[model samples]
Target: MNHFLALTRRGAIALAFALTLPLPAVAATKIQHLISPGGIEAWFVQDSTVPLIAMEYAFGGGATQDPPDKPGVGNMVASTIDEGSGDLDSKAFHERLDRRAIELSFSITRDYFRGSLRMLKDNKDEAFDLLHMALTSSHLASSDVERIRSQIMSGLRRDTTNPNALASRKFLELEFANHAYSRPASGTLESVPTITVADMRDYISRVIAKDTLKIAVVGDVDPATLGQLLDKTFGSLPAKAKLTPTPDVVATAPPQRAFVPLDVPQTTITFGAPGVMRHDPKFMAAYIDNHILGGGGLSSRLYHEVREKRGLAYSMFEALLWMDHSSLVVGNTGTRADRAGESIDAIDKEVRKFAQEGPTQQELDEAKSYLKGSQMLQLDTSSKLATAMLQYQLDKLPIDYLERRSGIIDAVTLDDARQMAKRLWGQGLVTVVVGREPQAAAEAARAPGAPPPPKAN
Candidate 1:
């Protein structure tokens, strides 16, 4: 055990050093497309500078694949998939990973179930074998399932009182309404307890298949050897995923707002509007425009207006969200209960003005420069580079996208930014506030009869 701890320490030190070293330009990184003898495919970036390997992979069916009644089946599977597999129990399985300093984790978003692995080159064989077992033969024992389910329920219970979580949940529920996208990625307290081991196994059988797989690997591995590893690790998965066809959705354009009342000291606000899809011609333009509006940290217009000028909130931000089935421009901020209405009004005015007039020439130039320069940060480490590569694959971008990305950003002219801004954010926002009722709404409620204020959850 001491030797294992020492090796883990050494591995952490090596990773820290690797993170400090300068990374090659993404365009020059030379992503190699590889196909295994068994026809499994992966994107590989060979780097011998560090004696470590990082792998990131995703499958198409994410939380959306969960049965309508079982909203968190996919999330539960992600939690328990690595607990044990094959002949190993949870303790024995984790012991093997700890001995080798292998890092394995799984996560799921609305559209994809994702997993990552990091291990020293010398331990690659054991690492891949364990990963293979986890994916192909996860042992979702009843005890393990209940343990993870308890953990999930604990989180869900906490979220019930969490102002931010409540606001986000309310916003999605109001926006998506009847759509599965409205379901929380983490299963709710009620739904999580009812999920059985059989349900988890069924989720894996339907979702973890070769046809939906996207893999990206980085570090000291050659194409031929990586191909062999790919086949050995993933080739056994079902040839095709039995995914339910999810229809594309556009965010509700009719302005909608809802409030979930909690006794917190501050109100957390989440707002959203329709946004351009990833493949839209104006996406790049809208991306830059969003940065100027709220995506840029303290330099953003929203931050300047809300925090710097009026002191309504400590921080504010807006971002473009492109999901597999829908797209949205979402923003969030928190402020004192009494000032929540002021914060909302400030944000609305800024958004409307920006949509009509767009970013200034200086703002546009600065945004473009920052976007280009910050690209390197995303690839500075092996794990980060692998994750970025996986996203590129998921987006269906060309192999040479990094090389042409700057050119694409540069092509967005002032006119494009203005047009995209109006098109993306001009529709107005669907807002959700959680905490004390806003001052204006409270006053109106006290007056005549303002529909008796929406019931608090």
Candidate 2:
């Protein structure tokens, strides 16, 4: 037994030594710069080891800049582009894409419009041309436009009957009031019909201009050839883009509870209040604080008290949303009608305690470690990298944002987190329940001694 133990110790030491030994240097990743003959600037990263290429395009004017009474037009127009463009009808375009095994996708967010294409190296040239036509000369077919519009309206109509959807939509509407962010990504039924092909054409031309576009290409290709390809794809678009006056998103006052009783087993609850924007000064601190409170899953305070200890709800969580003018931290959970009262009370107690006492040293350390580790994992893929890059560019964040992210989270002391929670998260939390109605729950809500729910949407 002693001999075996001695051998095991020696093996452990050898393993440690091997692990500490210097690793061979990896090839440096090179970011290539290109200026097309037509003056469109782009970034490319050449990786010859892979026979695949990914390209991303971003337009400055996002959903927020849609023309008046055309709330959903920006997204609708962007969707219609690839439905049928240039010489290809929708079916032909899809057939060619299928034959080439190309992946093409488009999306419109509150802040930016985006398109992406991926193809095998052998099909790069034809795939590029197909996407180029879709971007530059999409006919915005009237029939296709009407069909997509109808779909959007149908979705909105359906949302009206969905409890979960209604709760969330109402939360945003109440929280943002008249703010553009309050509008659905897909416009309302009334808003969709007002959009026109001319409107779509004008918006597409202005928004997808060369100057306002940022392109990221990653694949196996020579830098010079990639530059030429970019020229062929986007160079003809005019250099100057028509800029829209981005509306100032003003904060609405705290909202009152407008609960809608439903005859369902589960009541979907939603509440919204101003939180913080992504660029807020205390953003990192708030992020760290939130993780310890309810954002950390099993490790969070809400999980421990509500589900683990009291068995009030199976799941509970809170999240923060930072819009242009305002932000919100919202949480949700569901429980049996009878236990709903106890669940809300337990959740509120934790929130109040989190606000008052803040996180302990252990909680802060665990949260920081989790966040830093997650940061490493998020950067492991090219798609995630491109997505992060797009967000940073759209938000005008610092170039070192990626590298300095860890330091920011590390710098957040428990006090810093607590202070931020007290300042930002303390603005009266909004309580939203999406489960069966409970008389006890309503009484708990009305109790003056009960902690004020975060600004109810």
lDDT (Cα, tens digit) per residue for candidate 1, span 123-178: 89899999999998888998998888888898899999998889888888877887
Clash statistics: count for each candidate: 0, 11
Using TM-score as the measure, which candidate wins? 1
Q: Tally clashing residue pairs in candidate 1.
A: 0
TM-score, prediction 2: 0.83
Cα lDDT tens digits, model 2, 1-457, are 0000001111123223322332211113545566766666766656654466667778777777787677887888767888767888988887787777677767776656777777778888988898888888787787888888887788888887777777776777776677677787678778888888888888787788776788777667777778788889887777777867666664454435656555444455454456667787788888888778887888899888988888766467777765444567776675654565566678767877887788889988989999988865664445445555655655567655666778888888878888987765455555555444567546555778866433211
What 10-residue stretch in candidate 2 is worst by lDDT? 1-10
Best by lDDT: 1
TM-score quality measure for candidate 1:
0.92
**Model 1 poorest ten-residue lDDT run:** 1-10
Give all candidate RMSDs, comma-separated.
6.4, 11.4
Cand. 1 Cα-lDDT: 0.83
